[model samples]
Target: MADPKGFMTTPRQEWPRRPVEERVRDWHEVYVPGALLPIVSKQADRCMDCGIPFCHHACPLGNLIPEWNDLVSREDWRAASDRLHATNNFPEFTGRLCPAPCEAGCVLAINQPAVTIKNVECAIADRAWEEGFTSPRPPERLSGRTVAVIGSGPTGLAAAQQLTRAGHTVAVYERDDRLGGLMRYGIPAFKMEKHHLERRLEQMRAEGTKFRPSTAVGQDIGAAELRSRYDAVVVATGATAWRELPVPGRELAGVHQAMEYLPQANRVCEGDLEVSPLSAAGKHVVIVGGGDTGADCLGTAVREGAASVTQLDIYAQPGTERDEDAEPWPTYPKLYRLSAAHEEARDLGTAPAADADARLFAASTLRFGGDAEGRVRRLHLVEVDAGRRPVPGSERTLPADLVLLALGFSGPDRSDGLVDQLGLELEPRGTLARDAGFATNVPGVFAAGDAARGQSLIVWAIAEGRAVAAAVDRYLTGRSRLPAPISPYDRPMTV
Candidate 1:
């Protein structure tokens, strides 16, 4: 253990966020710069480094949580980074974007706040870059084999990096003009800056990984042609076919999907455009889903100077504390949590909703009322019970000039005809069908990440990528040595 009594004595202290007023003005990340390193070591010391270490079991990547926590506590930055990289291909991305289910599995969380594992991880990753600890590890000799990855998201990137280091010529194809997939456009800059992604792409290029942006496999190049060129093919295309809300006035001019709205805002930040055509300025915005994407929309709208913002949740509000009978310890619970976006909305009075956090739990959208020009002008809703049945005498309407449906995605988009060209089978849940070994029915073709699994966290995507790379490497060579973090059938703990 780093410290014998550290868990008992040290209280968890997370990285501090910048003042709402200062951060909302620009697109920089919310955390205060250079503030984590000073306090992270102490926070890391709180790890009990338990014999069983449920945190490790909880993480999809099987990250060496206790080991790295001890290393960070000892101030051995190099060793910590090395240990962190052993299982995870990109700690920087996960440290920022992952929900950190591992923390929920922390032993300390049974009684007290969990150790600041996420903050410690971010600090170590940032320090690794600053101290010149990270570098490209190109293969010493080529295997004379080539592989093609179909997406440029985290899953595709991780698989490509692994295959390249194993001496295979790997090429990643992305339909977007730039790489990084959702991290490039779906995610906003206020959550994570683009420079972090750019530097990592630079490192991947240094390692001899080839990238083909703006090249859609089924559209630009035939899938059969791609299969003939490469020895093996891995599909890591993410689930981006967004779900739509089928309600009255759905075709109104001001109603949009969250994906459509977010990407345009991100383009403006990328300097592709001076202003987003769908800017939320001077509009009363209503978001229909209450997941992380909805919170993202809330934050983006707040920054864009929306006149008012409100989020609707189909489920009732959860309790502040975990319910032991329903969700025991070491399992992620559905507790009421205040995200940074909700905090900004609450403080700025931008939501105008009765709820302090700008969210209406148990709220269901009935329909939208539009103006003569067919622009959405108001939203009609009703409160619901546990069974989702409407409660009596609880109907209301709110002004809404702009309505964003933040409902999540269903499965991988097939507009480019990738699935049809390859004749890939899909599961009942709308994901690409794959065997336990991450192999598709077609020989020499594999599927992983959200394409095989459903929409999931970034940590799970990286794990799936690593696992699929191992499967692909084994297929190419009679015998191989590559770490597979999780089995294709392995799933996360859910309540």
Candidate 2:
């Protein structure tokens, strides 16, 4: 152990974020650059090195949390980076995007604050890149097998990287003009800058993993033709068919889905556009959801200089503390947590109609009202009960110039014709049907990530990617050394 009494002696501290006033003016990440490296060692020392190590169970990738924590606490950066990369292919992405369920399940979190696992992971990853610890690991010999992976999201990228390292010739096909999928366009720069993605892509290219950007599989190359060309095909297209709000006045102008708005702002950052056409500048915006996507919208609108921004959650506000009767410890509980975006909205007083955090709990949308030009002007809603039933005499309206529906996604968008072209079967919930080994009904075609698992955390996507790569590897050769970290039936631990 790095320190026997470190858990008792040290307190938990997180990476400091940039000032709201300073961050809202720029598109860079919200965290202060290089601030995490200083305090992360002390935080990692707080890991207790539990006997059970529930943090491992909490993580879908089975990340070696305690081992890496010990390494970091001892200032063994090289060992820590090796341990961190043993399971997760993209620690930087997970460090920035994951909600850190491992921290929630920390043995220390049964009482005191958990160790800063996410920050430590990020620090290790960043230091690895800076110190030249990360380099191209090309295969020693060719397997004489080829694999084509559809979609260049986290899942597809992870799978392609693993397969290529195992000596299989792998090519990743992305519909977008660039790789990284959502990380390229869906996620805003304020969350994670694009250079991190570019550097990783460079490593993959050097390692012999081919990339085919702007090539839609079902359209540019038919699925059958792709299967015929490659020995195996892996479909990692993410779930992107957004759920819509069917409420009245849905056809009004200036109303769009969260996916529709986020990409435009990202394009502006990518220099593809001078400014977003759906920019929230000088407009009153109302977001209809309380998930991470809604919070992303809240931050984007604030940066865009929206006149006001309010987020609506259909469920009642959760208590600050976990309820033992409802959601016990060791499982991720529903609690009132303040994200950086909500902090910005609260401090700036952007949504005066809602609570201090600019969030309305137990709120249900009824309809939208528009002006003569068919532009959304106001949103009509009512207070709701725990069951989402409208309360009797609590209706209200708020001025809303822009309406963004962050209701989440359903499944892979079939409009590209990938699924139909492959003659693949889908689950009842719209996800691609897969067996225990992540294989679809079609023989050589496999599915993973959101396309097979539905919308899930980024960690889960990478885990599924690695697991599917193992399955595909085993199929090509009778035996394989690839590791599968998770199964198709493994669901997130819940009470």
Candidate 3:
């Protein structure tokens, strides 16, 4: 252990964000750069290095958390990076995007605040990139087999990198003009700058992972032709079928899916447009949903200079601390947490006047009202009870020029005809069905990530990608040395 009594003395410290007033003016990441360097070690030292390390059980990747925590406490960043990369293919992405269930599972959290595991992980990854510890590791010899991975999200990228290092010729097929899928356009720059995604793509390309952008597997290129050219196929196309809000004013011009609104802002950020077509600027925005996507919308809307922003959730506000009775230690608990976006929005006072935090929990949407031009002008909502029934005489109306549905996705998008063209059977949940080996019903075809597992965290996507690569490697060579992070049926520790 780095320090036997470290956990007893040090308090949990996390990476600090840039001040709200400053961050709201630009699209840069929320964190104050270089702020974590001094405190990260103390935070890492808080890891008790539990004998069993419940953090491992909580993480889908099964990362060696304690070992890396010890390394960080010792200020051995180089070794920490090495230890981190041993399991995770993209710690940089996970460090920023993941909710860090590992921290929730920390044995220290049973009593005191948990170690700042996510912050430490991010520090190690950033250090590795700066110190040149990360380099292209191309295979010394080719296995003579070829693989075609559909999609360019975290899962596809991870699988492609693993298969490439295993000596197979791999090509990633993406429908978008650029690589990285959601990492490219779905995520905003303020959360994670696009440069980070670009730099990693460069490394993957240098390592012999061929990328084919602007090619839709079932549309631009037929699935039959794709399968014929590749020895094995891995579909990592993420779940893009967004959930809908079907109520009055559904056909209104300003009522949009979160996917529709966020991507437009991202495109403007990418220089595709001077301003988003659905820019939230000078408008009152109401976001429906309280998950990460809704928070992302909240942040994006604020940055766009919206007049006001309000987020509505069906569930009541979560507790600040984990309730051991409802959710005991070791299981990832659902607790009230303030994200970087929420902090900024709160500071701006764009939240509803009465509900200053901008969140209206236990709320129900009755319908919507539109102006003469059919543009969304207001939202009709009511307070809800524990049973989700409307409370009596608690109805209210809010002026809203824009209504964004940040409701989560349903399953992988099939509009492009990839599943139909490939004749792949989908589970009842609308995701592609796969066997324990990550193989689909068709021979020489497999699936992974959100495509197979439904919508999930980026960490899970990368983990499943790594696991599916091993299954594919063995299928081709009859045996493989690649690591399988988790079995197909192994869900995350979260309920």
Q: Supply candidate 2's per-residue lDDT for 142.
A: 96
Task: Count backbone clashes in candidate 3.
Answer: 0
lDDT pick, better of 1 and 3: 1
List the candidate numbers ranked by lDDT, top first. Answer: 2, 1, 3
User: What pairs collide in candidate 3?
Assistant: none
> Best candidate, lDDT-wise?
2
- Error at 230, model 3, angstroms: 0.4
Off by over 4 Å in 3: 354-356
List, residue by residue over 273-371, the lDDT tens digit for candidate 3. Answer: 999999999999999998999999999999999999999988888888888887888888878778888887777788754264878888888889998
C-alpha lDDT of all candidate models, in order: 0.92, 0.94, 0.91
What does the lDDT come to for candidate 3?
0.91
> Model 1: how large is the Cα RMSD against the reference?
0.9
Clashes of each: 0, 0, 0
Decoy 2 TM-score against native: 0.99
Root-mean-square deviation of candidate 2? 0.8
TM-score for each prediction?
A: 0.99, 0.99, 0.98
